[model samples]
Structure formats: C-alpha cells, structure tokens
Target: MSDAERQRRIAEAAYHKARERGFQGDRHLDDWLEAERELDRQEPRRP
Candidate 1:
C-alpha cells in the first residue's frame, strides 16, 4: 500500500482501539490519530 493509505488504516485501527477502551474526547482521538499518521510518514518504507 501507499504511504497515505497505510497511515490511514493505522490511524483508523488505533482510533477504534482507543474508542473500545472508552476514549471519548475528539481532541484526544484526533491527536492520537495525527500522531500515528506523522509517525508513519517519518518511517522509511521497505521494498
């Protein structure tokens, strides 16, 4: 998958996991999601 797609899936998974654990604030979820995306963006992809 492309970087954007990979990041999106990772963020979505994390968001759902947090929600399942009772994370209710939009700000917290958004911040976590953005952090995941940023981390993925910084990583080098393997061929």
Candidate 2:
C-alpha cells in the first residue's frame, strides 16, 4: 500500500484502540505508533 493508505490504516487502528479504552488521557500518538508497529509486524519487510 501507499504511504497515505498505510497512515490511514494506522490512524483507524489507533482510533479503535483509543475508543476501546474509553478515549481517555493523551495517548493518541502512542496509539498511532503502536498501531503502525502492529501493522508492520503483519507484513513482510521489503528489501
């Protein structure tokens, strides 16, 4: 996927994660990073 699509997926995942925790506190950036890591883990690395 393109960078924009990857970012969109990460944002969506982060939003769901935040919602799952009741949307409290200031963890949006953390959520996004974690989501990106999770997505990265699911895909094979490109050389």
List candidate 1 segments past 4 Å from native: 24-46
Top lDDT model:
2
lDDT of 2: 0.91
Residue-pair clashes per candidate: 0, 0
Over 1-47, each residue of candidate 1 has an lDDT whose tens digit, in order, gives 68888767767767776677688665666656666766568764669
Report per-prediction Cα RMSD to one decimal: 4.4, 1.2
Candidate 1 RMSD computed on C-alpha atoms after optimal superposition onto the true structure: 4.4
Position 44, candidate 2: lDDT: 43
Q: Lowest-scoring 10 consecutive residues by lDDT in candidate 2?
A: 38-47
* Model 1 Cα shift for residue 1 (angstroms): 0.5
Alpha-carbon deviation at 13 in model 1, angstroms: 0.1
